[model samples]
Target: MVKYGAFVLFYLSIVWIVSSCSSSTVEPDAARLGYTYFPLEEKSFAIYEVEETIYSLTSTPVTRNYQIKEVIAEQFRDLSNEEAFKVMRYSRQNTTADWELDSVWVAKRTANRAIRTENNRSFVKLIFPVEESQKWNGNVLNELGADEYEFSQVAKPFTIANQPYTSTATVMQVNDSSACNMKRVYEVYAQDIGLIYKEKILVDYRQTNNICEGLGDIQAGVQLYQKLLNYGKE
Candidate 1:
């Protein structure tokens, strides 16, 4: 009876260990899979912005021959709140640069809010983190008087860099110029497979004239499917 009891105890111990390992080994939630944050000193930043006006001169007839939607895609890397503020301040200051001036100079000041995964190689959430572009363009900057008004818009969701992300944005203001509020959400494990899995956008205005309309989320799920096939193969 003593030997039998000891054997049973050992069997139970083995089962317990296996159960513990299995539970521990299970993948974490998509939100936690590779969440990454940065301390003040560690955060770094890079800037990229696009303007539609430049394409106005394009012989390709931007709205017809080329994909004009991609132009609004702006990206920023890890940056401190202070750094991001400066970037925005400068962006507002150099609206001409962001619109028609050389991209090289304005690109240097590109900064926006973003959340990256722990690996740094992937992004979990990358958003502009601005409440309203109009407030900045109007009251703060005083670039325009009472005669000017503004609004913004947003996109739905999408993926990038082999991960899934959701984009939410909409028209923020419609003052001297038309603008939109945009954001991107990313996670290590997302439902779709694509570089640009999904997108949601709202363009309040195109330039100085017409309101932005008929703009849809550019789907790239198919391309991501193909890329995944070649991923890590080489």
Candidate 2:
């Protein structure tokens, strides 16, 4: 009887351990996947103000300010019979200037992923079941090298231009810590608004040591910033 009781106690302990481990891995809610942040709805359009700075080794650095309008111009089925969107990009120097056709891109959303094809290159922008701190390869669909993408600030509040967003998700794409070269890229998407802000910086230190002394001096690189100025349907 003593040995049987001991065996039963060990069995119950093992069962408890297994149950604890299973419960710890909480299954993310499907409704909270953050797919609304991508907003593939037809007639969606977003305007963004762009500021770009270019650095050159032998020439003086230059900066340009402009605005871009991205509109969902068309929707069609891709080769795989998946729904795809054609995004038409238009650019203007200022509010009073005419919009010039800039570029064309494509985007699609699957049951498991949100993908955008820019310049004939496909990128897995977001994965379903958007759990905080979840990591995935942003370049999974493209030929580019593997890029680790992590989600943070999930469903967090963010404000821009005195406007408030209830929930936003930030994708941290690239953040290099090397001193000789620096590359930081990230994008912020607002729920029901698509992409709201972006920043990309890749610069090389100009000092004799070829290492970063500060952000002010750069040998050759580019810095780009895009912030949503307006958004609406159609």
Candidate 3:
């Protein structure tokens, strides 16, 4: 459970050469750019409530909820000698519990893109101009298979946790639904607040006679959801 849980929780980023291919693009306003959604300034931190659910074929499903804090600790040169930020993560059972150091990840935002390195996989999280219907390669830097990411709902106002965000965008990464299996992954970022929400769902249903008998019953899979609770810069 620990291995799969930790592996699924991390995020990924990419190479800078990927070209932007817009499909009926809706131009973003000049004031709300893509990089603002994921500010990488040192000492910036955000807290989130992470809920994870695991499903099994032989037993009932199990779920766990906890809180995590991610802080941009320091700036350093990555292997490629590019300027990057070191993000330290802490975990706790709840808000009242003390945070314990959990893991470390790297992130960098260039003039036109934002990149995150988690679990040794780098993926492009966002691209510049914040245009709706714009697509870019998410796995260009790593050996992982090609994955396309698109931006939608750009510079749109949203309300969460009783707080109103002036501008936000959605990164639609993957959406695959089948009779026996379903998988989806996406992340939302609010302008000036970084990642506001994320959800990843993967499920496998038991099939009989090569057909799904229990369409809604899970055989084995995982579901993870994260929502921002607070954010600040120190």
Candidate 4:
């Protein structure tokens, strides 16, 4: 989890650059904007909870319920999957929760080229995991947690935790019906702590990205989930 702090640092630095430019007369170079994280090409490990029901404290109650999951991983910057998984397993083994491994995933790269309105070109790279079904031609629909999904072509503005951002040209590279795309929004959240750039899949829809992979033969899904939670933290 400490490693995630570095990812936070990178995001904070980006925000600083933006703020510094906004305050000064100097025009920022939009072309120079980009992001990269540790475990650069290795793999990512974390923990996740597949919720069974919707719990509400208010009288109105929630009309819908979805699985709740936790992903703790090294925040993107300069890190490795080994570092993330080691820490994650240690944490879980020491924690009080009776959590067990849910799934394990291998990292896959998905790079996208975006042309800004100002004619600035930037490339965004996302490293996620591809589940067994997505990679192999095995079970179709008969499985419980596997489903195909599609994403919107239009871009949308959203906030992470609370920070605000403008995410243009939305894309869905993964297809998992269990994942939610509407309630959760992918964005770049600029907080006092740092910048958190990730995809917040809706709680109802646990969709996966084509950029991700579930290659390794391990069942420690919780560890991988936690790794993702800490994706931007370290």
Q: Which candidate comes out best when scored by TM-score?
A: 2
Writing each residue's lDDT as its tens digit, candidate 3 over 114-184 gives: 99998778889998878899999999989989988999899888677788888899998988878888888
lDDT of candidate 4 over 51-124, digit per residue (tens): 22232233222332222222334433213232212123322332355555444322222232111111121122
Candidate 4 TM-score to native: 0.26
Most accurate candidate by lDDT: 2
Tell me the lDDT of model 2 at 191.
84
Two-way TM-score contest, 2 vs 3, winner: 2
Q: What's the TM-score of every candidate structure?
A: 0.24, 0.84, 0.82, 0.26
lDDT of 3 at 166: 82
| TM-score (C-alpha) between model 1 and the true structure | 0.24
Better of 1 and 4 by lDDT: 4
Candidate 3 lDDT for residue 16: 21
By lDDT, is 1 or 3 better? 3
* lDDT of each residue in 67-183, candidate 1, tens digit only: 111121233443432232111111222224333322221111123323222222222132233232332322222233532222133234433455434532332222122232222
Better of 2 and 4 by TM-score: 2
